[model samples]
Target: MTLTLTALTSPPARVDLSPLVPETTRGRSAIEVAGTAIRCGRDRVGVGELFAVSGYGTDELVLRGELGRIDRIGAGMRGGRLRVEGSCGDHVGARMTGGEIVIDGDAGAFAGAELRGGLVRIEGSAGASAGAGYPGTRAGMSGGEIVIAGDAGQEAGAAMRRGLVAIGGRAGDGAGLRMLAGTVIALRGVGAEAGMGNKRGSIVSGRPLRPLPGYARAVRYRPPALALQLRRLRELGLEVPDAMLTGAWTRWAGDRLELSRGEILIFDEEEVAAG
Candidate 1:
C-alpha cells in the first residue's frame, strides 16, 4: 500500500492517519510501504503534496518528506514499523501502544506525548514534553521507549509514571518534572529544576548539575542497568558514546515534597579521568 502527500494548501482542522486503514499488521516480513496514502488536515489535501511513497513490504513503513506540519503520523499504532526520512510535526506517535517509530530528522513538540507502549526514535532534536502526561492526567508513558538524538525542550518527561526516555544530547529545563516512576537518561547536561518533584524515578546524565535544593547526595556507583539501555539505543541506530556506557555516577535522592523515591545520577568527572 502506498499514499503520496502532494501538498498542504492550508492547515486543515484535524488530520487523523490511524483511521485511514492499513494494509497489514502482523508477520515478520519487513513491510516496505509509505505514508503517502495518509490524509492531512481533515483530508483536505493529499499526502502526495508533501512526499513520494514507494516500496511495498510487510514489516516497515517508510516516509520521505519535510513533514514539518503533518501531525499524528502514527497515532495509536499497535504493530509494525514507521520510519520518517525527515523532520515531523507535533504528536508524531501519540498514544501508540505497540510497534516502532524511527525518525531520521528532528521532531516537533510532543514527539511521543502520552506514549503507552513501543518505541519512538528521533535522530534529531525534539520539542517540549517528549513523553509527558496530558493536562489533568496523572499517568504518562506507562510503557515504551523514546530516544532523542539531539537536544530536547522543556519538561522532557513530565509526570511520567513508567517507561524510559534516553536523550543523546542536551535536555532543556524542567526535565523529569513531577516524575512518578521510570528512567530518563541524558548524555549531555540538563537544565535547572530537573527532578524537581520526582517521586519514584531515575534521572541520569553524563554531566554535572546542581542538585535540587531538597535533594541529598547519595553515593557514587556504576549502574548496571545503563549498560542494557545503551545496548538498546545502539540497536535503534542511536550513537551512544563509549565514555557514557562505562562511567561512574554520583547518585542523589530527593523531592521530599513527594515520596523521595526518585534519584538523580550525575556522572563523575574524576571517574572519567581515571578511566
Candidate 2:
C-alpha cells in the first residue's frame, strides 16, 4: 500500500520530511516511520509527533495538508512517486535520481534544486531559484525535469548542468541566469536579464525578451526541435498553444562574456504581426 502522512497541525518551524522516501523507509514499519527523527529548525522531533503516519514501506507516498512549512519532501529518492495534496515546501524533489513528485499547489524556493533524474510537476506557481544551484554548489539540476503550470521566480534555471525547466507562465528576472547546459521554457514571458551569463543552454520564450547585453541575433524560423519539445510538454498535460507549437522563432546567440554557446529563442515578432 502507498504510504501516507497527514500533518496534524501547522508547524512552529519548517519540518523536514526528506527521510520518508522509499529508500530510507524500505524495511521500516509504520511504527518505525513514526520513530524516524525529523528536524524542526534547530531541534529534532519524531515524525509521529507532527504527522499521522500509515501504511509504511512503500515507494508511493501521499502527503496531505498545507505543507508549505515542510521541507525536502522527496529529497534523495531513487524511485517512486510522491504526491503533495497542498502547497509544498522548498526542495520538493532535490537530488532525486528517479521518480515523480507532483505538488498540487504552489511550491517554495529551489523546488527541484540539484535533481539528478526524475520529474517534479507543480500544478501551481513556484518560488525563486526554481531549478537553481545551491549557494555553494557547482551545478544545479544535473539531470531531470521540472514542470510548473504557473509562474516561476528569479533565476528559474540558474547554473543548471542538464535538465528541462518549463514554466507555463511568466518568469522572474534572470530566468536562465548563469546556466551551464539545459533547456528553460518560459512560456508567457520573463523579467530583466533573462539569460545572463549562460554558457551552453537554451531559453525558449513566447514573449519578447528585454534587450540582453551579451547577445546577437542569429536567425528567425520555426525550429523542429522546439516543436518536438512542445509535443512532449503536451503529453505531460501542460497546455501548448497552437501559436507556440507552430510559430516562427528568432534565435539569439548569447552570453558572449561566457562560452556564447547558449541561445534564446523568442517567438518571432514578424510572425505575430502577420497573424
Candidate 3:
C-alpha cells in the first residue's frame, strides 16, 4: 500500500514534519494520519490542517506540493521509504539510522547530517553541509551515502566518520573537514581546503586541485577499486562519464596538521562541469 499526502496550503512558519514518515503512518486511516500533530512555530497543527491525506499501506509514502517551509521531513527514519516530491527545508534526513529518503528537488542545509545507515539522494542542488556532523557532535554520516546531483554548498561532508558522499557537480570549500574516515567524491571538483583536517579519509576530485601545503604529491596510479565504485554509482542513476570510469588518479596525502592519513585523489585529466 502507498500513502499519499498533498499540501493544501503553506504554513505561516516553518514546521517540523518529522512524524509523518512511513513507519509512523503505515496503516493509519486518512483521518488518523491527518490528526497527527506537527509543530509550526510555537503552535501545533494537525497534519489534516495542512495536507490532503489519503491512502493506507506500509513501507511507502509520497508527499506532494510546495514543501519548502517544511523541515525534518524524515528525521530519525528507521525503516521504509519516504519520497519528497519537491524542494524542502533544512535537515531533510537528519540523524536517520536506517531507510531511504529521496528528494526530487533541492534540499536545505544538513540534508543528511549524522546519518548512521541508509541513503539520502538529492536530485538537485543541496544547501550547506549536505552530510556534515551536527554542531557540538563528534562525527557526521557515520554510515550510508549522500548523493547530490548538483552543486553542494560549503562543508558538504564536514567531519564525516564513515560512508560515501558523492557530488555530481562542484562542491564548495571544506568538503571534508576533520573527517575521521570515509570517502567523499566531488566529480566536478571542490573548492579550497577540501580536506582540511581529516585524519583518515579519501577525498576524490575529477578536476585538478591545487594541493594544500601540508600535502605531498604521491605517485599517480590507476585505482582498481574506483571502477567498481563508479559502476555502483551508475546503478544509482548517476551518469558517469566513460572517461571517468578509467583513468590514472593522483593521490595527495595530508592535513599534516592532524594525523596526515587522509588522501585527496585528483584525476590525472581534468574533468569539466558547470555550477
Inter-residue clash pairs, candidate 2: none
RMSD of 3: 2.9
Regions of model 3 farther than 4 Å from truth:
270-275
* Error in Å for residue 61 of model 1: 2.3
What candidate 2 gets wrong by more than 4 Å, as runs, is 269-275
Q: How would you encode candidate 1's per-residue C-alpha lDDT over 164-267 as one tens digit per residue?
A: 88898988999898899988888887888999899998888778888787688877877788778777778766677777678677888878888888899888
Candidate 1 CA-lDDT value: 0.75
**lDDT digits (tens) for residues 1-275 of candidate 2:** 66788999988999888988877776667788889899998899999988888886777888897688999999888898888998988988888889999999999999998889999999999999998998887788899899999999999998999989998898899888889999999888778898899999999987886448798887888899999998888888788899888778988897898999999988856643221
Positional deviation of residue 43's Cα in model 3 after best superposition, in angstroms:
1.4
lDDT of 1 at 214: 65
Residue lDDT tens for model 3, 25-103:
8878888998999999899999999899888857988888989999999998988999999999999988888899999
The local distance difference test score of each candidate is: 0.75, 0.87, 0.87
Between 1 and 3, whose lDDT is larger?
Answer: 3
**Model 1 Cα shift for residue 220 (angstroms):** 1.0
Range of the 10 consecutive residues with the lowest summed lDDT in candidate 2? 266-275
Find the candidate with the highest lDDT and give its number. Answer: 2
